[model samples]
Target: MIIGIDPGQSGGIAGIDGDASYAVPMPLIGKDIDGHKIAAQLKSLTPDVVIIEKVHAMPKQGVSSTFKFGMGFGIVIGVCEALGIPYRLVTPQAWKKAVLAGTTKDKDAAIAFVRRAYPSIDLTPGRKRVPHDGMADAVCLAEYGRQIMGNISEVS
Candidate 1:
């Protein structure tokens, strides 16, 4: 299985195994990441490799928020390392360019792309009206990894 993570409170993690895929929002406790929960998920997934979205603080973000975001990102990396899972970082631009292609580089575009790409999966959870853009991006990131990795058995 290949895992992809979008690190932030609003972000999500996705696991893709062949034609199957699963996603969940980043686990959080208050403003901090729930590392234990994340670790549990990673353990269960037993990913062969992980793909994390390379992110940085935005120009206009507050210091406190930026620090919190950084902390979450760190937790993700730490969990992957603790599990001994190989991982790669892909920038939002690069993944979008590869997976999203001709579509607009925006949340809505990603959502639409996933809707078309994975029609079997339910992007919208609970009773919410809209699809989760974070989940969509996570899936796209996984797709990007899968595309680059090609056939895993042939990689060696």
Candidate 2:
């Protein structure tokens, strides 16, 4: 299994195979919260590898949000490390282009492309759409990792 994470001020986790998937939006925890909560959730999924959305320095308008996101990301990394699960960090543009090939430079267009590509997935319909962006992005990362690994036997 591949576990993909879209870190936010409030983080999200998604587990995916070619056809199977699960997503959850997790509340942000202060430094006081037990890191084991994340580890436990991930452990329950039995992920073989982890894909983390790389943290970047966003524009000033997003500075505070990005900072909190980074903290959450660190927790994710630590959990993955402790579990000895190998991980890779993928940039937003890289992940977006990989999943939204031939459709870049426009965020809305990329989102639309993902929705169109994975029509069977509940990525952008009704109230589910609210969490779709982050969840879909994580799914994209998982799919990308599967593609790179070049085999579905394990995923299946």
Candidate 3:
């Protein structure tokens, strides 16, 4: 199985096993990342490899928010390491180019692309009941990983 993670409060984690796929919003305890919960989720998935979105602080973002984002990213990496799950970081541009192809590079476009690709999968598993960009991106990242690395033994 392969796992893809979008590390942020609004972000999500996705797992793809054969033709089956599952996704959920990043678990949080209050405003902080619930590392234990995330670790448990990852352990349950038993991913041979994890693909995390390579992200950086954006200009105009507040210092506090940037710090929190960095902390979230670190928590995800730490969890993977604790479980000995090999992970690769892929930039949004790179994965989008591979998975989204000719579509415009934007949240709406990503949601549209994933909706079309995994029509049976529920993109909106949260309370909002709306298509989620983070979940869509997670699926894209997983697809990218699958494309680049064929089988479980092929993960590097």
Candidate 4:
């Protein structure tokens, strides 16, 4: 299994193996992060290569939001380290170029791309009218790792 994570409140985590994949929002309830819950998911999924987004705070962002993002990132990394899972951190630019180049550079475009890539998956029609871009990105990130490992031949 390959697991990919986007470390933020609006981010998501995904696990994929062979023809199966699972994606969900980051396990954060308010300020307290449920690391145990995320750990459980990863333990169950048994990722051979865990991939996480290598993101940094932007200069225009507020201090509190940046700290929160960092905190969430720390929790995810902590669980990976504790579980002894082999992992890699991929920068957003690299992954986006590798996986999202064909898409139109928007959340809806991302949703459409993931929908086409994983036809059996229901990444479309998320809560309300908003598509789950985070989920799509997480899955795409996992696919990026899979491509790097030569596990899948989809990358161009």
Q: How far in Å is the alpha carbon of 94 misplaced in model 4?
A: 0.6
Query: How far does residue 21 in candidate 3 sit from its true spot (Å)?
Result: 0.6
Worst 10 residues of 1 by lDDT: 147-156
TM-score (C-alpha) between model 2 and the true structure: 0.75
User: Per-prediction TM-score, please?
Assistant: 0.92, 0.75, 0.93, 0.88
List the candidate 1 regions with Cα displacement exceeding 4 Å. Answer: 151-156
lDDT at 58, model 1: 98
> For candidate 1, lDDT tens digit of each residue in 108-138?
9888887888776667777767888888888
Task: Identify the runs in model 4 with alpha carbons over 4 angstroms from their true place.
Answer: 124-127, 151-156
The lDDT-based order of candidates, best leading, equals 3, 1, 4, 2
Q: CA lDDT of 117 in candidate 4? A: 82
Go through the candidates in order and give each one's C-alpha lDDT: 0.84, 0.67, 0.86, 0.79
Where is model 3 poorest over a 10-residue stretch in terms of lDDT? 147-156
Flag regions of model 3 displaced more than 4 Å: 151-156
Candidate 3 on 1-156: residue-level lDDT in tens? 888899988888888888888778888899998999999998888897899999999999999999999999999999999999999888898888888888787888888877887787688784777787788888888888888885544333
Indicate the residue-level lDDT of 144 in model 3.
Answer: 81
TM-score for predicted model 3 compared with the true structure: 0.93
